[model samples]
Structure formats: C-alpha cells, structure tokens
Target: MRDLEGRYVNCCSLRYGLSFFIHFCNIAIAAQRVCLSLTMVVMVNTTYSHELHNSSTNELLTNVKNPVYDWSPETQGLILSSIFYGAAIIQLPSGYLSGIYSIKKIVGCGLFLSSLCSLLIPLAAAFGKTSVIVCRVVQGIAQGMASTGQHEIWTKWAPPRERGRLTSICLSGFLLGSFIVLLVTGFICESLGWPIVFYIFSAYGGVLCLLWFVLVYDDPKDHPCISISEKQYITSSLVQQFSSSQQSLPIKSMLKSLPIWAISFATFGYFWSNTILFLYIPMYINSILHVNIKENGLLSALPFLFAWICGILSGQMADFFSSRSILSTTNIRKLFTTLGLLLPVLFSMCLLYLSSSYFSTVIFLILASATGAFSLPGMMINALDIAPRYYGFLKGVTILVGMIGGLISSTLTGIIINQDPESPWFEVFFLMTAVCLACLIFYLIFGEGEIQEWAKERKHTRL
Candidate 1:
C-alpha cells in the first residue's frame, strides 16, 4: 500500500512538470508563429516591387501595349501604395474588436483571408491592373487585422518587467520577415516565376494560421493545457505589476492627450522613412549600384538581418534596465527613441553625399537600419507603457496615421524617381531626414511612460 501510494504521488509530480514545460514552450512558439505571419504579409506586399523592377516586364504583362497591363515604374508604385489604403481603413476596427472579443479568432481569420488574397493575386494580375489593385487592398485589410490582434495578445501574455523584451521578440519578426522575403523572393521569381512566390508564401500563411489556432489562447486562464502552478505564477506576476483596471476606452480623453499625439507623430515619421527604405532599397541598389537581380536580393537583405539582431539585443537590454531599476521607463523609452530616429536621420543625410561611393553607401544603409532597431524597445513599446489596457486601440491609431506616411512616400517616390532618375533621390532623402527630425523634437517634448489616468478604471465603472 505504501509503495502504490508513492507511485501515484510521483505520477502527479511528473504530470505537473510536463505541463510547466508545455507552458514555457508556448512562449517560444507564439513568437515563431507571429514572425511567420509577418513574413507572409511583407512577402506578399513587396514581392511585386522586385519582380516588376528587375524581372522581364513582358512576362509580367498580359498585353504590353495595353496601357493598363504595362508594368511601368508608376504602375508598380501605385500597386505598392494601394495596400496601405485598405490597411489604414481596418486598423481602428480591428484593434477595437481584438480588445472586446477574441484575439485568437481575429488574428486567425485575418491571416487566413490575407493568405487567400495572396493566392488570388496571380489571377488578379492576369485580369488587369485594377483587379490587381483591388486584390492588394483586400490583402491589406486582412493583414492589418492580423497585426493589430497580435499586440492585444502581448498585453495578456507579457509580464510588466519583460514587456520590452517580449514585445521586441514579437516585433523582430517584422524585420526577419522582411529579410526572408527580400532574400528569397528574388530567387523564387527568377526560378519558378514571380507568381510562384505569392503561392508559396500564401500556403505557408495557411499552415501558420492552423498552428496559431491550436497553440494560442486569449489569456492564461483560458489555456486548458497549462499547469496550475505555471498559471498561478503568470497570474501573480501580472497582477502585482501590470494589472489593468479594465476601464472602458476613453476615446475623447485619448485624442486630446498630447502624449498620444506625440507617439502618433513619431511613429508616422518612423514609418515614412522605413517604408521608403525597405520598399525601395532593392530598386535603389539595382539602379545606382547596377547589381543584378540576385546581388540586389542578397545586398538588400543584409540591412534587415543586422536590424533584426540589433532589435533583439536592444529589447533584452531594455528589459534588464527595467528589472534592475537602473533607469526610469520614461528615460529609457526617450533615449532609445532618440537614438533610433536621430542616428538614422544622420545616416540618411550622409547618403546624399555618398551617392558616388558604392561601399560607403552600403555601410550607411546597414547602420541606418541596424540602429533603427532601437525603436522596437523605444517608441514601439511606449504605447504599452502608457496604456496597458488600451494598447490595442493606441497601436491601431498610431499605425493608421503612420501608414499614411507609407502611402505618401511610396506614391511620391514613384512620381519623383520617374520624373528625373538622377537628382530626384536627393529630394526624397531630404524629405525623409526632415520628417524624422521634426517628429523627434515633438516626441522628446511630450512623450510619457507612465500609465494614463484615462486608461484606469474608476469607481462604479465597468470596462
């Protein structure tokens, strides 16, 4: 009887241990899947930019003489810009839905729809430019929902101390996705044809969506397979440091807040420069450096690879500072935000003078991208710091405003570059630099790291 009872106790212990391990694994899996989803969206959006600019236009077009199907520089720019229109429209709605309803369902449905749209792109292109633009718009809407939903998940999963690192880990997926797409899309287009790039990436998205549905839960309490001990640990940690009062969103208050506007403007400047650099880097390399398609792919990917590493390191460092109480959260956010924006501004300005030297130009590009990684732990996480409960809504608003910068940059680049290939770049680079400086000044004056009163629950009020 003694031996039998001992065995039963041991079995219980083993079961608890296994559950704890599974809980740990969930964090890593969540990060990986989010990275994959980001890769899918970025891959689909940027694939055509390289294909149209570098590949044979005759192959891409159904009728070269039919103005609608002609893959001109202007047409390529418009198509890239079109996605932002749809993305901007859905950001607010998606964030509100994620906060109020099931984050898992919103993310899964969005990714599935985006993947479906990607598969339809090849067919849409065959129809006409208008059809292709429509497909991109639909794709943008789905991806916007998916991206916004992920932030809501972080609010539930990330502990207060680990917020910077964990959020960075999740967002680093953006850089990684961009890197993978830039590196592989060129080869895929060259070998299997550009259409295959969309098909393969879309298929991967479908697979990732299935995995996300199986693995993720909306909150720790909802995860069936998690151990009681692990769940308690998570709950206790969160409750002590990051508990939200679950207040109803105070939209009027938020809009009137200067700190919120600072975040918005800062993000707008960051995205403006980022969109121009990422979307056009390959084209820029091909045009100025005169590298072949394969070289352009490899070279363009290098900046993103460095940026991903830098982003992860910055995140870890930010978490360390917070955990050890080395610096106030506000100072940490501001310092890094300045480093991320200011360094890139200087680097971009240097590009204007270094246009003649291939080696110098490449080095500056790498520095700009890698240093900009600081923004991950800086401005990107500021929304969470200021409004833990309302991060989804805040993120949605920031992204909505920010993506307009992307839209304008893309469309303007197309027009300017086409007007005069030689000197047009000067204006583009100058504009990016000026915008970054202005936003940086505004953020430094007004940004805050403490939770806003409006985000807290008041007596007798329900969230």
Candidate 2:
C-alpha cells in the first residue's frame, strides 16, 4: 500500500520536479553571471585606490598590493556590459526556437556552451581585456538562450493558477545564486585565488547541463518518466488556453500590442535596478561604507539573501490572491510590480541621505532588495499571461529590452562614478528612480490580464 501510494504521488508531481530542476538551473546561470562582480574587486591593481574619504577630509588614499591587472573603471564597465551585447543578439532567436523546437535541448546546449566559455575566462585574462570580454560575451550568449528557454518551459508545464508560485520559485534561484556568489567570492579571492571561482561555477553549470538533458522534457506529452495521470493533468489544464505548440509568429499584431509594450517598459526598469544591485552594491559597500573586501562580500550578499527569501514567499502570496479571486490577474501583476520597483526606489533614495551610516544603509538596501523581489511575480511572468502560445517569443522581446537597460545601466554607472566617485551617487539613484517610476506607471495603465486575440488558438479547417 505504501508503494502504491508512492506511485500515485509520483503520478501527480512531475511538474514540481520540473520546477525544481529549472530552479537549480537558474542558480547555475546566475552564479556564472554574477561571480565576476565581486571577483573583479580583488583582481584589479591597487596602486591608486578609488576609496573615498568622509566629507571632513579630502586626501586620496593610496595602497600598494599585488593586483592581477590594471584595468580602469571605464574598461571594467565595458567588460561588464559586453555580455549583454552578446545576450541581446541571441534572446529573440533562442526564445522563438525554444517555442518551435525542444526546450530541453536548447536550454541544455546553452548551459553547456556557457560553462565552456566560463572555463576559458581565466585563460583569456592572460591575453588582455579584449580576450576576457570575448569569453564573457560567449557566456552571455549561452545564458541568454538558456534563460529564455525556461520561460517557454512554463508555457507548456505551468497551469494558469500556479504560474506565480512556480515561476517565482524558479526565478528566486537567480537571487539565491547571486547571494551564494557574493557571499563566497571575497573569501574565495582571498583564500583560494580568483581563478578557482570561475572553475567551480563552470563545473557546476556543466554538471547541471548534463542533468538537465537527462531529466527534463520540452512538454508533458514528451516526458518519458511522467506518469499518464500527470501528463493528462498538465495537457488538460493547458488545452483550452493554448493552441498547438507550433504557430507562426504574429509579428504585426505584437508590434501593435500595448500590453507587450507595457511589459517591455516595465522589464526595462526592473533590469536596470537589478543590474545596479548585482554589479555595484559591492562597490558601494566598499567605497561608501568603508567595508573591507571580505566583509564587503558578506554585506553585499545580504540584500540578495533577503530578496530570495521574500521572492519565494511573495510567489505563494501572489498565487493565493490569484486563486482566491481576491484580485484580477492584471491587478495582481501591477500590485507586485509596484511594490517591487517603487519600494526599492524609496530605499535607494534613503541611501543618499544616510550614506554615512553603514548600519542604516545596509538595512535600507536589504529592505529595498526584499521588496524588489516582488517583481518576480509581477511583470516578469506577464508574457505567459497575455500570450501563452507565444510566451517564449514575447519573453525574449521583453528580456532583450531589459538587457539593453542593463547594458546601459552598467556602462552609464561607470561613466557617472568615474566623473567623481565620491559625490555622483545621487545622480545614479535619481536616474534609476525616474526610469522605474515611469515604467511602472506605464505598466499599471496598459497591462492586460487575459490573452490577446492574436495569441488565441485557431481551429483547424478542412482542406
């Protein structure tokens, strides 16, 4: 009887397994993407320190250390931003291909390729900045494809009511990865050397790529290990909502879609703020709060840890509200997006006022990140809402827009800080706030809950 009950449970839970696998996969993706943010702090030359002094003093601090390279802030920004350039090129094509081909294969292959590029990065650094950037770009391309494929997977596997929960759980892996990376990177740089960071994270992605190929399937009907009952449950749930898996691209209609535009704008703002958090928070802790490298890593990671925890919880809350019909889908998405984006802006603004208080600054940053994770259940999964059939494609478009935002954010941040590393933070916060508020307002006004006519399934006609 125990064995029979176990079999019955397995017959209903394959979707959950899929969600967990993707969750781990996202962790791998994020680890590789964010490892460099902290690692670079230790890699650069320190002949001239960029650390700032309090308002009472004006002396520039100088330190001598065994630094690996002497790349300037502008060059570092270019290297950080280069990945987005490669990712932007692939997101649209990979997103469309994932919808048309096997999502399992596309995602697995992308991870494999990205992992390989990660292994090459340390060696590339020996040649110079350009070589490192090239390797990073390749990694970005792989990550872009794999990340987009995950969205397509949800279109096939997730029930409408479960989307917020499943998608949020999966995306929370991103923050988890960032947390783990930031938490360990400084220690690793100080103890094991920075190259080991690349090797460790790359090996993780390679192993996950193998497991993904072996265990994951593009659709419920195609999964060999899924029980008949499980397969039937997924298919039946999605049948009325989506047409056949393959459909021609509705280019013209999508071009005219206000909801799509709303998603794109919101995604742009979301990623801009996220990029700042992921790339610059460590620098802020080090430069403004006067934290050492090791403590900087731990402190930088705190926000992401809080964000990850809150993201998973918010997913459940969003789903509860959705399932109980307490709020319409549009309202739910808007509500979460507003909380995530707007709250962070307020917290970030507080940083400008309390820049001198390390404890206060850390608390606000943590609060900001915790609230920002709400976006995971907000605009992030909205593509699945308006276009279940073309979710992969729409996700690609919006993510591409978001990547552009990130690219600009990283590059522009360097330019802003390089102008005067001491006093330019206000400008940075102001720009991020403006972009987020503008985008959030647009999303609230125009976003939709139901499927678009162009995205609806078409009935077959007799020849």
Candidate 3:
C-alpha cells in the first residue's frame, strides 16, 4: 500500500512539472525586449554602412525599394536614448502596479503592446526619425512594465533555496537574446533587409506573449494544472520566507538604507558599461576593424555568449556555496560583486592600451563582459536577500537609476564619437574603469545579504 501511494505521488509530481516548463517561457519573455532593442542597433549600423558605401545617390534612392533614413549621429543618439527615457518613467509605477495587481496580465499586455510597436517600426522609420523614436518610446514603456512584472513573478514562484539558479537562468536570457539578435540581424540585413529583422523578432514576441498567458499564473494556488503536492511544496516554502499579506512598501526606510543605495549605484555603473558595449560594439567593429556585416554580427555576439555561460556557472557556484555553508551569503555576494566590477575595469584598461590589435581588443571585450556576469548571483539577486517582499519594487528603482546611466552613456557616446571616430578611445575606457571602481568600493562598503529590519518587521507583524 505504501509503495502504491509513493507511485501515485510520483505521478502527481510529474503533473507539477508544468511549472518547470513555464520557467522556459519566462526566459522567452525576458528575451523579448533585449532582442528588439539590439535589433534596432544592428539595423541602424547596417543601414548607415550601406549609405556610406553607395555613391550613386539618385540611382540608389530610386532603385532601393526600401530606403534607409539619413539621420545625423546626434539624431541617432536621440533615437537610442528615447527608449530609456520612457523606460525610466514607467519603471516605478509598473512595479507598484505588479505588486498590487495581476502580474500575469500586466506583463502579458506589456509584451503584446511592445510586439505591436516593433512590428510598426519599419513603417515608423519610413515616415521619419521622430516616428521611429515614438515607436521605440512606446516599446520601452511596455518593456519596463514587463521587466518589473518578471521580478514580481519570482517573488511568488521561486523557492528560496533555488532563487540564485532560477533567477540566473531567467536573466541569462538577456545575454542570449542579445546574442541571437546580433548574430541573426546581420545575416537578415544582408539577405532580406533591416525591416525583416524587426518583423521576425516581433513575431517571436507575439508567440511568447501568447505562451505566457496560457502557461503562467501569479501563484501556485492559482495554477490549474499544478499537482496538489507541488502546490503544497511551493506554498510551504514561500510561507516560511514571505509575508502572507501585502504590506505597504517602506519607501522612506528603503530610500534611507545604505545597502539599497549600494545596489542602485552599482547597477548604474554596470548599465553604463553594458550600454556602451551593446549599442556601440557593432559600430566599433564596422568602423575600426572594417568587418563586414556578417562578421560584425558574429564578433559582437561573442561577449554576450560568454557572459551567458558565465552567469549560469556563477549562479550554480553561488548556490553550492550557500547550500554548503562554505561562505556567508554576505561574503559570497561581496566576493562575486567585486570580481564582476573589478575585472571589467582591468579589461577596459587593457582595451585602452591595445585598441589597435583587433584580436587583443576582442579578447578583452569578451573577458570584460563575461566577468560582469558574476553579478547575477551577487548584487542582482541581493534584493531578494534583503527584501523578498519588495524585490520587484527594489529592482524597479535600481533599474530606473540604471536606465539613466544608459541614457547618458548612449547619448555621450554619440557626441564623443561624432566629434571624431578615431578620437583617442583612452578617455572613454578610463571613464568606464573609474565608474566600475567607484561602484565596487561603494558596494563592498555598504552591501548586505541579510534581510532588513523593515522586512523582518512586516513578517513578524503578520505572524
């Protein structure tokens, strides 16, 4: 009888595996914005390269069925910066709403809208620069909400012990998405044209939005197909870690917290460096190395691919150490965070000195990006450690600040590079190094892995 019961439970457990499948879907959703955003970068660079080479202006304009928009570098910067401007505006409100309302619907709708905007981008570009910026801004607003909603999902779904691995798996999609876009967009541009890149990625977003609605639920209790055993397992794990009722976010206290500031500032630094890599790497490859579009795509993708692998490996190592009690969570967080920031600084310095050697520069770029992936299990997951209940809100606040860094970096790169493409890249490399160093110092000083008093108080009061 006991054996029979065990078999029955095992069968039920298989039914519960549906939620595991949903994790992959979550990855797809996470990938959507990244793919769309970088696709634009690839498209713009390819179009600009085309314009530069084609000398028969009248014949080219007339013969080319779909003409690329001729925008100055400054205007291109504005278009790139516009997305982050909209993203920053929506981050806080979207987080708040996801916490209070249905995360599934909020995220689903956001992705759907963003997908629609992506589909319309080709049309917008045909109209003019302003039109393309408007489309990108709308997409950014939608993706901001979607991103916050994803963090909120983790609060409800991620088991405390498995948080590092699960969150890393989800976040790694960003790098994967970037890799795919950079690699594929180049070939797509060469074969089909830039417009097809937008259409293909938008279609992917549409499919993911549909899958999200079908497979995902806010909590275990709401999942129709989840077996009772799995539901009990999830509910039991979360109940121990989280408050049953939603409490008002201690905004004032959060703002006053040293650790929160550390996370935000560190995130700002990471974003500044990452934005430069993502938005400008294609241009760098084209302008400096004189690589063709296909080679440019493959080369640009290498760093992100390395980063994705490193992120997964670091996450597993973090979980192993935590499980074994080999290191305090605080120390682990600090160790990885330091490595992530410090190595990138060193790599950037190497780039400053060796920019002329294409092979050496590529190696440094890949190393810089890969080392930064250590932060996935470090500062990126630190919010759940300090405030699981408000992880979404905290992530939103940090990302809002980070987007400001992205905005400044993107615009500033345009201005500086426009002045002279061959200008000494040393200053830019030095600035990246300094930003990384400062953030590392601040995080090492103030970052914590312990839950804050405010979070503990809320849980205690509920008890």
Candidate 4:
C-alpha cells in the first residue's frame, strides 16, 4: 500500500510539470508573433507619414483663397524648407542613439511621437507661427529615428541572399509611401484642409505603436514568433557576413574609414537633388515661375511617380549583378552611386535654363529622378555589405551628413529665391551641379568594397 501511494504521487508531479512547460512555450510564441508584427508596423507608419504630406504640390498653392499665412513666393519656399530643416537636425542624434541602445525601442518611439507631431501641425497652424514651427520641429525629431533604426534592423535581421530584395522593398517605401501620401493627402486636403492631415496620423500611428509595444524584441535569440526553421535560416546566412567578433563595434575605426567617408560625402550631394525635387519644387513652380496651383501639384508629383519605375529596376539590377557574379560587392555599389550622382548634376544644370519650357523641365526632372535608383547599389547597400555590425553607427554618420546637405541646400535656396525670384534660382542649380561633380570624383578614388578586408585584418592583428 505504501509503495503504491508513492508511485502515484510521482506520476502526478510529472504531469503538472509538463503542463507548466507547455503553457510557458505558448506564451513565448505569442510574444514573438507580436514582435515580428510590430517590426512590420513601424514601416507602415513611416509610409503613412510620407503619404500625408505628399499633396504639397497640389494643395499648398491652390487651397489658399484669402492667403492668411503669407504665401509669397519667398515664404512658400521657407515653409516647404522648414520641414526639412527639422528632419536634418534629428538625423544626427537618432543615428547615434541606435549605437548605444536597441534600434527597435528608438524606432517604436519615433513612429508614435511623429504621429503626434503630425496630429498637432494643423492645430499649431491654426494658433499661429509659434505652433507651426514647433510642430514641424517635433515632426523632424521623430523622423530622425527612422534612417538609423532601419539600417540597424537591416544589419541585425536581414540575410545576405535576400538582402538586396528586402532593402529594395524598404527603400521603395520612400516613394511608395510618398505615392500613398499623395493619394490620401491630395484627397484629404482637397476635402478637409491641411489640418486634417495630423488628425489622421493621430488615429493611425497611435494604434500601430501600441501594436509594436506588445510584439517586438531586440535580438533573435529571444524572439518568440520566429519558427525554428526561420531562426536557423536567418542566423546561418547572416552570421557569416560578420567575422567572429563579440566585441561592440569600434566607432573610431569605422568613422576613420575612407570608403565610409566617401559614401557620406556622396550622399551629402545627392540629398540636394532629392530635397529640391521632393520638398522645394512646389514653390519653384507656383511662386518663382508662376504656374497655377492645380497644375503644379501634378507636375511636382510626377517626378516621384516616374521614379517608382526606376526604384524597382534599381533594386532588381542590384540583385541581378550580385547573383550573376559579374561585379564584386564594392564595384556594384559604386556603379549605382556614380550613375545616380552624375545624371542629376546634368539635369539640374539644364533645369536652370529649361524652366521657361514646361515640357523640357518636366522631362529633365523625370529623367533625373529615375537615376537615383543607381545609388541603391552603392550607398544604400554598401552599409550592409561592408560592415553589417557597425552599420548602425555608420548610418548615423551618413544621416547626420546627409541632413547637413539638406540644411545647406534648403537654407541656401531659401536665401537665393527670396533675394531675386527671376534669375538667381539658376545659380542654385549651378552650385549644386558643381558640388555633385566634386562628389563624383570622391567616389572614384576612395570608396572601394574591400574596406571590410582592411577592418578585418586590423581586428585579427589586435587579437
């Protein structure tokens, strides 16, 4: 009787232990699903924000009847440029923040906070300049988290075989987000006025942030939703791109690298073209050149619409070259950078002369916009290819420098357009052209793909 009771108790204890283990596993799996989902949602919000402001060309000029906010050609340029100034200032800190902390947390916070800024903008404008610039600055600070965080996630999570395609997809969001933004903001501003833009973000972005908070974890070892197959797939492929080092990436070494500096410098020039087209074109059309507001929206939006084709082609081209073994990683990246940079220089130079002919202006703008895809190979992908571990820091450096480019372009253009609306705008294009050529020479000499080799050799000797 005693032996029988002891055996039964042992069996019951084993059953309870098994049940507890099963419950823990279920909770863990659910948590991972949440993380993966949130990871995706962050980009969705980014795309949404891009969409919200997309109506700049259409709504900004035409919607004004009484013109209370002072829509002079000069001020219009200032207003458009204001948002970018905010964006540039944030990029420096956001990039560096990722190196010190988790990318996921920073990005998650950014999405939610930017949404609030988006929500507040219309309210601020309603109140006056105190509100408007403050909200714009807030939006800029929120957005700063994106570029650095995105690069950090890419370096941490993405696999080499699929790296180009995945990157392209994320990169495509810049245009696609703008596309979606154009479609929504155009309709909303047409019906609701610009104030409603932030309202929409408040509702949408807040929900997405809530989802991210529950789901995302920083590292793969802890992530719950990832199946064993997926985990093995991600790790086996990605881990080798990094040499065997558990040490935190040395910032000094990365900052000093010539290739990294080349990409940074090159990006500085390219951003001038990007900002002029995306952020500043509306004023150029409506105030300086005297195009109607309705026509200006479609015209300003057209270049980005056209670039959609190029963005896709550029990504595919990047993958195609690598898969075929035609160019090493470095050369492939350089090819895109070289082409994207040079074409814009030419088109922008012509733009100064061609603004009189609307058709020629549009054509050059579209052609130039399409060439930006070329950088997909070099500046975009090289961060991952050359040093995945340190990409977070490098991305911060690049983002900081790029924002400075925007600041210079926007500030300079603001002064130029304000001074003499008729002719000096040509000088802005000319100055940018000279700068782009200087950047082209830079990439040719310094930004080789073999930079990782130099880094690895240094690491080995120290060991």
Best by lDDT: 2
Query: Per-residue lDDT of 1-463 in model 4, one digit per residue for the tens?
Result: 1122121222123222222222222222222111111112111122222232666765445444112343244443344446556666766577666756776688778777766776665556557655666666666666667545656766555655445655664565456445445445555554654445446646666675666566655555567665555556556666666543445566677767888888888888778767665656666667555676556656666766566567667766876676567777777778888878888777766776665776777787667666765676567667777777666667777767877886788778878887977776577778878877888788778887644753452443553
Ranking by lDDT: 2, 3, 1, 4
Residue ranges of candidate 4 with Cα displaced over 4 Å: 1-86, 183-186, 214-217, 220-222, 243-251, 286-290, 349-358, 451-463
Per-residue accuracy of model 3 over 1-463 as CA lDDT, tens digit each: 1132132223234222433443444444444445544445534544454543656785465325345556776687677667767778899999788778888899889889888887898889878999988988898898788866677877777666556776776777777777766666656655666677678877877887888788778887888877776667567767756765889889899989999999988888888887777667777667768887667778888998898898888887887777667888888888888877788778877776765687887898788767888888888878888888888888888888888887787667767887866753566667777887898899999999888987764434553
Best-to-worst TM-score order: 2, 3, 1, 4
Global lDDT of model 1:
0.72
Q: What TM-score would you give candidate 4 relative to the actual structure?
A: 0.76
lDDT of each: 0.72, 0.83, 0.74, 0.60
Per-model TM-score on C-alpha atoms: 0.82, 0.89, 0.85, 0.76
Each candidate's root-mean-square deviation in Å? 8.1, 6.3, 5.0, 13.3
Per-residue accuracy of model 1 over 240-327 as CA lDDT, tens digit each = 3355445577889998899899999888888888878877887778777888766776888898888888887888899778767888
Query: Candidate 4 deviates by what RMSD?
Result: 13.3
Off by over 4 Å in 2: 1-12, 46-67, 70-73, 354-356, 420-422, 460-463
Which residue pairs overlap in candidate 3's backbone? none
